[model samples]
Target: MNPARFLLPLSLLAAVACSSDASKKDPVAEARFENEKRIGDENITEKQERDATFVVDVASDGQLEVELGRLAQQQSTTPAVKDFGQRMATQHAEISQALGVLAEQKGIVLPAGLGAEQQKTRQELAALTGAAFDKKYLELMVDDHANDVDAFDDMSEDAYDGDIRGFAAKYLPRLKEHLELAKQVQDQVEAAK
Candidate 1:
């Protein structure tokens, strides 16, 4: 056997092994590897990003219901719920308008009604009265606001479009304030009953 042929084969194997190890060391590749582990076959893609935005829009609409329900349920009875509902109605309406404009501009259409979770909440709130209504309403407000804030924060951080990021940035503060108000109202409701 020729020494040159033997040397070439060994060098080729070494090069292949080294390249494989180098590919493993790359951070972008590593991060992608991690993502693959977490998301499995449901990979994040541009189409998925667009579809995911509808979920966000639906959430915005749901927040409107949560706020409006609080207003409608309590305005006749509870002053604080009325006040907070007014704020919710105003802020959520504005967010809805902004999202509408963005949706038009982006050519995305949101689903017509609140998803099942929001509808269930709406029905649950509708069925209660007085103190029970106030407690359940305040609990929903707090939970909804927390979720709103987090969703917006994540969108701001990782959204695929300028419109989505802008929407998230514009709404996050309002969501935080809503959460705080919800907490205060919960405390007041607790003390009152």
Candidate 2:
């Protein structure tokens, strides 16, 4: 290529670059910038943000519950505990999936596994078997469900997102039912031991 031919195009390109308005914003960049600037819009208030955190914590617990319940369903000698485990595993897996989708839609980030306390609880359970496992698992179930029922009941009424509120509302009674089942199984395990 001729040196003059290359030099002419380079000069023209530089001239064109210098001619455009530097202040003119790119549409995609503008939208992205606006989105970042508008982080947590009016629809997502501090209360809603707190609710989102609640949703994520619940999701994390849900995943742990499902995993633990799956183990129980496999290992429990007690038929009632096994049945309860199966129910918890099935119901909680579904809830986790729903919460995952909702969190994505709402631009909330949820951790993939159990939180520290739940992880510790899971580790403790993993070290046990037979009656010990049955008793501990049932006890945990009762405690977890009692807490979950209250949390869901409160969220059902107070959550800013209608879907989240409806979700909590739909599941509050289910959690209560699970709590009742857990209590019954705890009684059985206690009597047997």
Candidate 3:
């Protein structure tokens, strides 16, 4: 055989070998390598970011709502305030339990307590008494429930996982109900103030 023919066959064999090696790469390792290269370019996976944010935020809000509801139950003079507070405590406790179970199933870690802003709000509510406590508490509820409704609505529509999306959808209507009631209660408190 001519020298050129011999070289061409060798080159073809090398190309095939290289391609097979590339095909043999571990998919998981390759993905990690690609992800590592993206570190400085906002490269954290969306699933990771979403899960982290959801767990922390949901835990913090649940803790804050439960604590505030208990405070309302303890300190309010008005029957309506007391009832609302008790209802909040009861409902949010259930929500927290459900969230905890879901987070556990998803292997997500959650914070033990409220975030800074929520803690500050809780501390402020703790310091108030009588009509001041009732007014501030109702106002906070209206605001908080408004935020909750928005967050839950977004999750219901946008979550990538079916379980999470379903959870958000199931609770969104209840959140809306709480917001409407909170608004009415807030208006009532304002009128009396």
The regions of model 3 sitting more than 4 angstroms off are 1-44
Clashing pairs in 2: none
TM-score of the candidate numbered 3?
0.77
Query: Per-residue alpha-carbon lDDT of model 2 for 1-193, expressed as tens digits?
Result: 6899999999999877877656467889999988876775744677787788888878988988898898898778888888888999999988888888888988889997777888898888888887889988988898888999989989999898888898889888888988998998899888887
Each candidate: what lDDT?
0.72, 0.86, 0.85
- Per-residue C-alpha lDDT of model 1 across residues 1-193, encoded as one tens digit per residue: 7899999989999999999987768889889998887786455565456545644664556565545555554532678777777777776766777777777777776666567766776777777777777787788778877877887888776776766777788778877887898899889989987
Selected candidate, larger TM-score, 1 vs 2: 2
Q: Each prediction's TM-score against the native? A: 0.68, 0.74, 0.77
Q: Candidate 3's residue-wise lDDT over 1-193, tens digit each? A: 5999989989999999999988998999999998878874553467557855865687788889899999998889878888888998999899889988888888778887787898899889999988999999998888888888888888888776778778888888988988888888777777876
**Candidate 1 local Cα displacement, residue 11, angstroms:** 31
lDDT of 2: 0.86
**Weakest lDDT window of 10 consecutive positions for candidate 1:** 67-76
The superposed Cα distance between candidate 2 and the true structure at residue 190, in angstroms, equals: 1.8
lDDT of 2 at 7: 92
